[model samples]
Target: MDPLSEVLSLLKLRSYVSGGFDAAGDWAIRFGPHEGIKFHAVVAGSCWLSVEGELPVQVNAGECFLLSRGLPFSIASDLSLDPIHVSQVLPPNPSGRILSYNGGGDYLSIGGHFTLAEGQADLLLQVLPPLLHVRDQLGSATLRWCVERMRQELAEGQPGDFIVAQQLATIVLVQALRFYLSGRKAENPGWLFALADKRLCAAMAAMHATPGERWTLQTLARVAGMSRTAFAVTFKGTVGLSPIAYLTHWRMMQAADHLVSSRCSLAEIGSAVGYDSEKSFGAAFKRVMRCSPREYGRRQGGKGGPMLRSGPTSSSTHTGG
Candidate 1:
């Protein structure tokens, strides 16, 4: 599988559709820093997303964006408008119903949050930008389909709503990643850029496809069809890490996921990711995840359990796509 596919599969993200929102005239909503990733899709009308440290981006109908790293931001009709906290305007509604906020103009959108694997969000975040903007997804059938599915799931609240929504959310992120990578130049630096390089892509695919392989620089270089010296230089330059370092990161990410989602023994988990022993795996995991394997499981809400979903489950007001 491709690196992006591998990363998405390992994340085991749970998505919750937080209904929809409608606003008219002068209005802005501040979404506070959330624990999980948040996203917004403009179904009708337009808005400006003002994320700190980046210029406000104008999003029209059919456009969507993903905000990770829990950076607080505001969506407004205009950048000059004073914003109201989403909590203040939307308020809590015990009754799950469509929400509307009247200002003057008509705007419609749907939003939700994605809860990633416990103690392993940073591994995925490190490869993606803080903001992933998909301008005019109307032209992309895949994106449109995913959004429509999510909207339907949120609106109908059928028996399989949660499962369908979660699946759609994964598709949305995958499509968004494809959109971002396709738009970026080959020379760009980052994991995404690295995936674009044919030689590096070969090596990355190898690493992701078989994390337990006893991979060495020489073997990886052979996989990339490059000499050891050139592959090492290009891999580090393109991926921002040595080949071994990247492999370790990938292994630990897989280990973290298994630790939280499975009932396997620590030694089995370690061996699955190429570690020879449980002690070695624990050391590497601590170095990367900042916690011991047992501690990490506890922090993740205990072993062999579902990851906790963060953010608002049900809100008073929501607007549909």
Candidate 2:
């Protein structure tokens, strides 16, 4: 798999469109900052999206905005309007219906959150721009199609709608990432930069393709067609972690997957992820995932699967480069 696909697979993003809003004249809703990403798409009429530090951006019909870093922001008919909290505007009505917001003019939009379903979200999505604005429906047919599908599914539920909606949401997120990266000038250096490097891409592909392989520093450097020292320094500089560190993260991720998905013993899962013994694998998994393997598996299997604990709310924003 390609580097982007590889990373996304590890992330296991699960998304859903919820709480549709139909507003009219003088309306605004403030979304509090939280972990994960949020997206809004205008179906009819226009609205303004304003985050802290960035100028208010007008999103017309057929346009969409993605806040990748969960920065606090507000959407309104006008920037000067005092915003109502999203919770108040769209109360906890579990009926899954399009909510009507009547003030004066006619407007309609849909918004939702994209959550990392598994793996390490902070590390996997760290390279993404904080804010992504994609305009022009005609140019982005795939994105438009995904949004429309989601809208249709949300408005008129059917059998298997939940799974289909999730698949479409994934497509929307992937398209957003592609659209954001397409216009990137490569001014920032990180995984995006490293993915574009031919040698580094080769090395990453090898590591991802076969995490169970007995890979040494020398072996990985040879795969990248570089000397040991040069590859070590270059990999660390480009990826922000040593090659072995990255490998350990990947291995732990794989082990976590096995623990939740299969009934394999600890020893079996460890060996599958290149660990020689369960003790070594448990040590590394705890260091990376912040919990022991058994506890992680129990949490995953029990009621209410793992969720990122909410942190302090803030409006500080980071714009897309």
Candidate 3:
């Protein structure tokens, strides 16, 4: 798998809550600080989305936005209006339904949140902006189709609708990320943006494809078709980390995943990630993750299961409607 796919696969999404609300006349709803990424697409009409500590953004029909940091936010027909808490408008326990306010009609939106496995959210969050907004021109028709289908699944309440809606919501999140990557100019120094540079991406892909390979600056530079000095300077400038630093980080991440989800022995896990000894692996894990492998696994309950599961509220964001 590619680097992006590898990272996402390791995240282990647990649950998500998919739903939306409709309102007519002047109205605003305040959602409290959230734990995971929240996404919403304007199915009809428009509103102002005000995230705490940021300027209010106007979202029009056929547009969508993602809230990455789990900040408190408000959606309103007019920002001047007093916002009602979302709990007041939505049932105490949301059931993935289309909620209505003031009899419904004028404004409509559909979306949800994705919750990742314990202690794994930062892998994606560290590389994301606070908010991502995707306009119609930048978004694909497939995203629009997913939004419409999600709306139908939530509103109609057909058998198996929940499963279908959840899958579609996941698709929306992926597509939004794709558009963001495609439209980005690589002006920023981040692993996500580094993919925009073909040379950097080729080197990154090699590391991701074989974290167990003992990679050196020269080997990676050769993979990128550049001299060692040039590759080191460029990689640090663009990816914000030396090539070996990134390799070690990626190896620890892979080790952590295995530690949490497998019954592998410490030596086995260490050897798989290119560490010949448990001592080296433990030191590296502590350095990158701020904890030892055993401790991290204990914190996560050390259960083995499939990487991705269906559920509610987590982290990440997207842009578009």
Candidate 4:
């Protein structure tokens, strides 16, 4: 359970400042992400969520949508877009009302931090479609429960407001995952389908849980209950990446993240990823990330090394503390 515990712990540390906005006041509310996933809920009435580089995704009262991956996005109201720093529309459409705010109840939003965790949690989270919107008709019951839970947290906001919000976010996430898992059939290709097979899911969990394990084609093959040759071909075809590549990529990604967020030394990082020597680890890191561990750490600190000078001082995927 330690694996599941790690995933839950990171999520527990996350919260999307729980609050509501009312349209009766004709007020304009805005915020900037300066580092995690944000979950916005439309509690009552409708408001416009205008994200740059994409059209405004409308939300009726009671609907919930995550800003996908928390990229630099914006939400605004009608008759007033000011005080809100909106990204300028390229090619200047200045013509369409991206989103329409209607009369009704209050507008509610929940913002929370999100990150990659270990094993099942990490792999499951990776399959999510960017910018998930749960319609009332398609995902109503579970969505309603999530909305009510968040609403309660926002209203009571007691001694455990943070903890309660974290729980609600998880519920919402699980609900979304449930919907995503059942929504499509064999007709549509999806990342989550990889988890549909019990064998694949179990094998994946083992590889992720112990990247440093002396895992090989045969080991993973046995886990999947398939012959080495068959598993190798199927794994690649279904996952779009060879099993070895997938393991290496996930290990390096974890190593890179640790380099940025943890004080673990290079030797520790190498050991964590199954490398016996710092040279081997550094070589793998460079081969994959195009930079050494130190330089990668610098980029993760929010200052770019060479290519990405203008964005993310902390190499973070989300904004804010």
| TM-score for each candidate, following the candidate numbering | 0.83, 0.78, 0.89, 0.66
Candidate 3, residue 103: how far the Cα is off, in Å: 2.0
The residue-by-residue lDDT of candidate 3 on 1-321, one tens digit each, is: 777777778887643546778899999889888887898988899999999898898998877888889999999999899999987877777677888888999999996888875676887877777788877774478888988888898888899888888888788888888788887665557788767678888999998887878788999999999999999999999878898888888888888888777767776777778776667777888999999877777766635442322223222121100
Q: TM-score for model 1?
A: 0.83
For candidate 3, the lDDT comes to 0.80
For residues 183-279, write the lDDT of model 2, one tens digit per residue. Answer: 5654555665677678988888888898878777898999999999999999888887788788887778777777777767776777777776666
Q: Predicted candidate 3: what Cα RMSD to the true structure?
A: 7.9
Q: Of the pair 2 and 4, which is ahead by TM-score?
A: 2
Per-residue lDDT, model 3, residue 23, is 90
Candidate 4 C-alpha error for residue 280, in Å = 1.8
Query: Lowest lDDT 10-mer window, candidate 2?
Result: 312-321
Clashes of each: 10, 1, 17, 13
Residues 233-306, candidate 1: write the lDDT tens digits: 99988878899888888888887787677767777777788876667777888888788877776677544574
Candidate with more favorable, higher lDDT: 1 or 2: 1
Q: Where in model 3 is the C-alpha error above 4 Å?
A: 185-188, 302-321
Q: Which stretches of model 1 miss by more than 4 angstroms?
A: 94-97, 103-105, 137-139, 152-162, 186-188, 294-321
What digit string (tens of lDDT, one per residue) describes model 4 on residues 15-69?
Answer: 4443444344354555565344566666666666655466767777767776544
Q: What are the Cα lDDT values of the candidates?
A: 0.77, 0.75, 0.80, 0.59
Runs in model 4 lying further than 4 Å from the true structure? 1-13, 24-35, 45-58, 69-130, 137-143, 185-193, 257-265, 297-321
